[model samples]
Target: MNFFKNIIDKFAGKPVDWDELEEALIRSDIGVPMTLRILKTLRERDAWSWVTANDIAEVARDEIGRVLPINPPPIRPLPAHPKVILIVGVNGTGKTTSAAKLAHFFKTRRHTVLLAAADTFRAAAIEQLGVWAERIGVEMIRGQYNADPAALCYEAYEAADKHNVAFLICDTAGRLHTKSNLMGELAKVKRSLSKHDPNAPHEILLVVDATTGSNALAQAKQFHEAIGLTGLIVTKLDGSGKGGVVVAIQDELGIPTRFVGTGEKLENFAEFDGRDFVRNML
Candidate 1:
C-alpha cells in the first residue's frame, strides 16, 4: 500500500520533525505510548540531523524490525504422530478461510491433514469448514449444531490418532475477545485435547484481520494473555488497511507473525518474511 513511500513523503527530509513522524506513527496505529518511545530513541541519538528522508525511512523500518522478535518462529513439520494445531479468533477475522488455506498449504507438502469442525455453536462454521475439507480431499470430524465443541475436539484427536494423520487442525468457534466465558470455553478445548496428547495443540495460531488496524494489537494481546499463542496469522493484507498492527503486536508481545493471508485465494497465504515485509512497508 505504498506504506514506506508515504512515510518518506511525510518526512520530506526534515530534521527531527516530531509532528510529521508522530502523524505517520499514529496513522499506522503504533499507539501513542510506543510511538513516543520510538521517537525519543531517535531524538536521543540525533538521528534526524544526519538521516535523510530515505535514511529516516530506513531507520523507521529498522526500528520496527529491531523491536519485533527479529528471529522467526520455527515452522515444525508434523511432530510424532498428529501435530495438533489449534486455530482461534473472533468472528469476521477470516478464521475459517485461514484454516482451509493452512490445510491446503500442508496438503501440498503431503501431510495427512485432518480438520476438526469444533465450532458447533455456529452451524455455518461446520459447513464452511466441511466445504474446504472436501475441496482439499482431507478428512474432517464434526458435531451437530450447538453440540459440545470440547467433545468434538476430543473425538477429533482420537480420530487423528486412529488414522495416524500427520497433522490435526482444530477450527474453534469465533467469539468476541470481551467474552470471558467464550474464551474460557477455548481453554477447555485445549485442556480436553491435551488429555489425548500431552504435547498436542503444538501451535496456537491466532488469526488477526489486517484491516482492523490497531484492534489487531488488542486481539493479539487478549488472545496471548488468555491462551499463550505460539504465533500470529494476519489476514486481508491485500486490501488497503496499512496492516501496521503486525509491527505493534510484534513490538509489544514479541509474538512472531508466522503467516500473512494476502487475499481470498487458497495460495494467498504466505510465510511472514521480515525482510520482504520491511521492503513492502517502506
Candidate 2:
C-alpha cells in the first residue's frame, strides 16, 4: 500500500501542514485515534522547533514501536518430532499459499517439514495444497473430499511421529469468522491435534491479506476468540493493503505478526521486524 510517500516534499522548514498530515495518516489506515496521537506526539516532541516531515515520521515510527513491541512473542520451540503449526484464516486471505511459504521457510533451515491438507470441505483447496507440497518438495497428508477435518488432523499428527518430521504444519479450511458452524469445526480440529500430543498445535498462526484493511482486523477478532491465536502471518503486502491492520491487530488483540508476504514468489516471505516495518511505513 502506498502510504506516507511524497508528502514530505509538500513541506519545507516553515509551518507544517497539520491538516494535510492528518489526512495522510488517516488514508494510511493509521485510524483517527492513532493519527491524532501521532500529531499530538509531533507537537510535544518539539513544540518550539520548526517541525519537519522527518520529525513527524520519527514520532510515527516511535509510536508504532511502542504499540508493537520489538520483542516478538515466543512460539513453542521445535524438536518435538512433529511440531504442529495450525494455520487459520478466512477465504481469499492466501491462507493456503502462506502455509506453503511457511513450509519452505522451515525446510530451507534444514527442518524436515510436512503439510496436512486439512481443508477437506473443498476439493480445490485440497488439490491446491497438494500441488504446493509437491513444488516445495515436502510430504503432504490429505483427507478425502468432504471428510472430517478433525479426524484428518489427528491422523496427520500420528503420522508425523512415524515419519520423524521436525515440523508438521496443518493447513485448515478457510472459513468466514461470522459463520458459527465453521468456526466451531475449527475448534474441533485444534482439539484433534491435542489428542495425539497434548501440546500438539504448538502455534496457531492466523493468515490475513494486507489488502483487506479493517475487514482483516474483524476476522482476527472472531477467529482469535474462537481459537486462541498464537501469532499472525500477514500476506499480500505487495497489494493495496497499507498493512496498518497489522498495527490495529496488535493494538487491540495483542497478537504479534510473525511473518509477512511481500510477493507471490516463495522467497518473498520474511520474518517480521518491528523497527523495519515502522521505518518503511513512514
Candidate 3:
C-alpha cells in the first residue's frame, strides 16, 4: 500500500529508471496492460527522461480512477420474488464468511434475508455458516453433507419465495477455477435457479482475496467466463494494501468490485467506493 509513497521513495530526486518503474508498477498487481499504459503516458511527456516518481504515481492514479466505476449500482431486491445472490470462490478466500456478512448487510437495511448453506461438499462449511446464521438471527436452509449443491439451491429458492424473503444468499462450495467439472456444477446451479425466475440468481458475486493480487484477476476471468459474474466481493483488505486487483479486474475484465471485507467482524464489510479506493491507493 502507500502505492504512490513507495514510488516516490524509490525514484524521488533521481531520473526515473524506466525498467525499475515498470517492475514496480507490475509488482503492485495493477496488471501488465496498465503498467504499459502508465509507462507509455510518461514516455509521451515533453521531458520523458526527466520524469519524476511523483509524476509516475499521479498518472498511475489517474489511469486507475478512469478504469474503475465511480459508483457501481447497489444490489437491490426484486419487486416480486426473492433477489437471489450466489456466492462463489476458490478455497480459503473467505467465501462463507462473506456470505454471512452480506446477509447481515441486507438485514441491517431492514430487508428480509435468507441464507442457503449450499456448500455441502464440506461438513464443517455447513456448521460454520449455521453458526453465523444463528448469531445474525437469520433463517438458513441447509442439506446433508455430500449433497448435490445445485439441488439444494433449488430447494432453498423455493423456501425463500414461499417466505417472501427480500434476499436469498447462497454460499456455494469452493473449488479451483480451472476445474471444468466443478465449473459445470455451478452452471447447473444457475440453471436450477433460472427455473423459478429467468433471473433468479440476480447477482453471481465472486469472493476474491485482495491479498492474492493479480491471481484474483485470473480467478475472476475464469469464473466470469463459466457462470457470468455480476460483481465481486473482495476480502481481507484490512492492512494488506494489496487492493490493486480491484483496479486490474475492472481494467481488464470490466468487472466492478461490489463489496469489500476488511476484517473478520461482520461490521468490517462495506460497499466498494471507487473514489475512496483511488484516494487510498496513494
Candidate 4:
C-alpha cells in the first residue's frame, strides 16, 4: 500500500529503526511471520548502520520479490482435448466473476471456451454465469434447480467434448467454511472429473477478495488444506490498495497468485504482473 511509500518518505534522512519498520509492516497487513523475516534481513544487512531510506526501499522490494516469484509456473494446458477448471471460494469473493474473466482470457487466446453453471444452490449465481457466457460469447452448460454439483461437472465435461471445445470452466456454489456438506460437494466435483479424464479438473483455483485483509489468509489456508488449491485469483485490489496481503499469502501457503482483478469490467482482470503491481501500489 501507500504506507510503504510513506515509510520510505518519512525516514528519508533518518536511521531505519526496527520498531518503526515492524509497525509499518503490520499496518500494511504483512503478517507477523513475514514482517519478522523482513526485519531480520534488514538487521543482518546492517541497515541501521549507514543505509539511506532509498537503500531500505530497494531491500524491501527485493525481499517482497524474493517471497513472490514473478514468473508464472508452467501450467498444464489442454492436452489433446479440453482442459477442465474448477473455480471455488466463499460467497462474495467474486468467484463467478473471476471464472468469467478466465473464460475471457482463454477465449482471447483462440481457445474454444465453455462455461458450466454448477452453482444451482443460488439461482442468482446460475443466472450471473449465464449472462457472462452470453456477453463473452461462450457455450454454457447448466442444470435444473438443486441438481447435484458433481453431476453438473460430469455433464459439462461431456458437453465440452461433444462441442469440441478447448476449455471447460465450472462455477461452483460459494459457501463459507462452516458448510461441511457444501465443501464435501466440492470434493465430489473433483472426484467426478476423473470419470472422463483422470486429470479433467486440471486446475483448481481459489478466488479471494483482497479487501478481507487477514481473513484472506485464513480462507487461503482453509481452502488450500481442504481441497488442494493449484493457484489463486485475488479481486478488489484496486479498492483496498493493500498489497502486503500478497506477501502474506506467499509466506503462509506458497500458493502463487495467478490473476488479479482491478475493477468490475471484464477487461480489468490481468495476469499477475508483479513489477507493475508494486509500482502501482507504491
What does candidate 4's lDDT look like per residue over 212-243, in tens digits? 87888888888777888888898988856576
**What's the residue-level lDDT of 60 in candidate 3?**
84
Displacement of the residue 106 alpha carbon in candidate 4, Å:
1.1
Worst 10 residues of 3 by lDDT: 45-54
RMSD of 2: 2.3
Task: Arrange candidates, best TM-score first.
Answer: 3, 1, 4, 2
The candidate scoring highest on lDDT is 3
Of 1 and 2, the candidate ahead on TM-score is 1
Per-residue alpha-carbon lDDT of model 3 for 167-237, expressed as tens digits?
99999999999999999999999999999999868999999998999889999999999999999999988
Best of the candidates, TM-score: 3
For every model shown, what is its TM-score relative to the native structure? 0.92, 0.90, 0.97, 0.92
Model 2 agreement with the true structure over 96-136: per-residue lDDT tens digits:
99999999999888888889999898659999998999999
Residue-level error in angstroms, candidate 4, position 85: 0.9
lDDT, each prediction: 0.82, 0.84, 0.91, 0.82
Separately for all candidates shown, the number of backbone clashes (residues 3 or more apart, or on different chains) is 2, 0, 0, 0
Candidate 1 residue lDDT tens string, 86-201 = 99999999998899899998899887889999888875889999999999899999889998888898999889888888888899999888888999998999899889878778
Name the weakest run of 10 consecutive residues (lDDT summed) in model 4: 70-79
